[model samples]
Target chain A: MSNPFQIPEQEQHELDQLGAELRDAMPEVSLSEDFHEHLAAKIENSWSIRSAFQNNRMIRMAAGLLVMTLAAAPVAAWVGIWPQQKKNPPAIGFEIPEEVNVDESGGALGDSEDNQVTGPNDEFEAVEWSPQRRVALERYNRLVTAVASYELHGQDMELARFEGFSDQSAWASASEESLWLEFARRCAQADLSPLSAELVARCTLMLAAPLDRNASKQQRAAYAAWAWLLEGEQAKAADLQMNWPSAPFLTQN
Target chain B: MSPSSDDLLTRFAAGDPAAFDELVASLGPRLKGYFLRQGAQSSTAEDLVQNVFVRLLQNASRYQASGRLDAFCLRIARNLWIDHRRRGGRVFSSEEAFDRADPRPGPVQEADSGDRAVHLRSALDHLDADTRELLELAVLQQLPYREVSVILEIPVGTVKSRVYYSLRKLREQLHNLGPQEDLS
Candidate 1:
């Protein structure tokens, strides 16, 4: 008995014939004789460069040392270990007044005369960086690095790096409007002078206020135009501007 | 060839130059064929294959032997093509202009049975980009349906159905063109 699922012999023959024809028709490509030599040379060159980079450990060590020295300078000055020079005055330590009442916001709430006290107090009330704030700052740095990496590498690498860090989930989970606004505020506060103009523009555009609810069609179009401009798609941005003349972002110089 | 692809890849990752050479020998033709069939120029296909190898060398540590190397390499090729299209400002539309822009000579036009070959080429090209890709992966690459699904990022069922329909479409197009040219 023949199997019900089997293709008819004629149909199978035709398909087999088609496959044969296709195989014949398909072009056979081969690398040139020198291709392997060229690839091997490239690999060698890459290896040499990589080895050179690895061997230059002294430069990295020097950089680390410089950072450490810079970091310790303030501590040395604070501890009065550095000798006073004509240009650089000796650091003076401050003593917190014992009678001063400090508010939760770190504001002095008592008279200066009543608060006058000698020597540094271990219990001095000051606005210390909270753990949450520290984490936020770290996450912000990672976000900036991630964005830069995305620009330099590509989306897949960026996504992989992002997946390695859990803090990114918080940003992703947040509302887009709030996230953009927060990013804008942070970008404004950041020293973005070191970043390229394109990155600065990306940060700026990311921070751009989302279209207001009940906004006109022109406003929405303008926002999109600004977004495209930020993303370096000048042609699309120009088209949007042309179509939506009333867009406020387009009007801005 | 004694060791599997996974073994070769693992050795390649360990910086075994011989293993790398072995991989290059094994994968080079397949990669070149895939790119050429996908309408890349010979030079561009060579460049793409080189890039894939370079990427593999760089990201060797990230490879998991459990995952098929062919699928991984094909995915990279696909990504490179996508990036190439994006950089050229070629937006995806019904008719992919980039595929048509490929300057390389397509399927052996000078074959003995020229009309049939030409008709088959036209039919193959006429299929939608996805269908064409499916055929390339399933038929031309001769990848198993499971591996094809992995490369295409679709379910095995979808692969089977899509491949069936794509083949049916190709057959129908051939039938419409004229009687099948006898293979014998």
Candidate 2:
């Protein structure tokens, strides 16, 4: 295509002469002799200010990471101690079903006469606690604590605690399936009827685990509805609730 | 050979203070002329120039070597001008302020060439703002059409057409002023 800005050869020459005449007619304006010096000083001052700002940003980032790591250290230690502490003689009334036992040998434990057992105790002795299993248990316990804390308190403390355990470097060796199963078991064992928005959210994320092939459609829908409600997607949650296949087990806030 | 403006900008970006000095020296007059021609007072032009350089330094890291530094600098100057306008500051008209007080006689005027210069300045004042700016960029500043396009954020074709019409109008004004008196 021809250049749009181009003019005919003769007109171009005339325009050039006009340009030259205009340039000649224009008054000459020069900057002060110290113009360059003043400009350089201003540039240097600005550069220093910008450098300080960037340095401040990097320092703030480093400090934030440090604060986060320090805050997470104790929770990480608590999670690490959980699996070992659970290995003591099974709490008196804690019982494990045949199919879902997590003991090292994968054997089912005898049923307990009392069903009021509380706290972190090994109800089952069937599956051996491998290093991987220990890490998974740690994650499970951390998430459970996070959910419980969020329900009792508010989002901020719970989020900090969750972020603590969910830090990638801390749980690098744990398998997601193991942690997921533990989360599911913890949720199932707890009475979810008094559910908080926080617990509902945790349930939604945990239920998304691929390992739970046995969960009924109603259970999935219920979890999904709760997730939607907690996420402020009230309309979607209401729609799902209206078409629910069965009555939801969890209480809606 | 002198370094290209882009080269100087790249050096400045790389933290060479002297390169910044080189840039200021090279582009300072043109920038001042731009502000003056656009009707800024000499002091205001100087202040605007300082502001432009300050902005350039602050945003140096964002400058891409592949881009035109001249256009970039002019864009900053234009934005500052717009901001000044928004703040409700008066922009003096260079052509209307025909009797600008200066110690030095304007470079183009010899002992007897003042009338032609006055006529040209008066003619320039009559053009609309956009047309005058287009003429300033294409003719007085001598920027390439492409660079003008970037600075004004317009198509080169538009710049060309506008320049053509602006020059035609200016030529008519100059012709109507009749012949210049003999300069011999």
Top-TM-score structure, candidate number: 2
DockQ of each: 0.12, 0.30
Question: Against the unseen true structure, what C-alpha lDDT does each candidate score?
Answer: 0.55, 0.59
lDDT of 1 by residue, A1-253 (tens): 9988666777767675676676565545567566687776666566544544344667668767999999999998866754323223112123122232222344432122333233245676654543323322333343343233333333232213221113443443344334333323322232122323343334344436555677555444434433543333332333322321223134332
Query: What DockQ does model 2 achieve?
Result: 0.30
Fraction of native contacts (fnat) of each candidate:
0.25, 0.54
TM-score of 1: 0.47
Candidate 2's C-alpha runs over 4 A off are A1-9, A34-37, A44-253, B1-3, B95-101, B106-115, B178-184
Chain A (candidate 1) TM-score to true chain A: 0.19
Candidate 2 chain B worst ten-residue window by lDDT: B95-104
lDDT of 2 by residue, B97-147 (tens): 323524455424542465676667767877888888888877887778998
TM per candidate = 0.47, 0.52
Give candidate 2's error at residue B79 in angstroms. 1.2
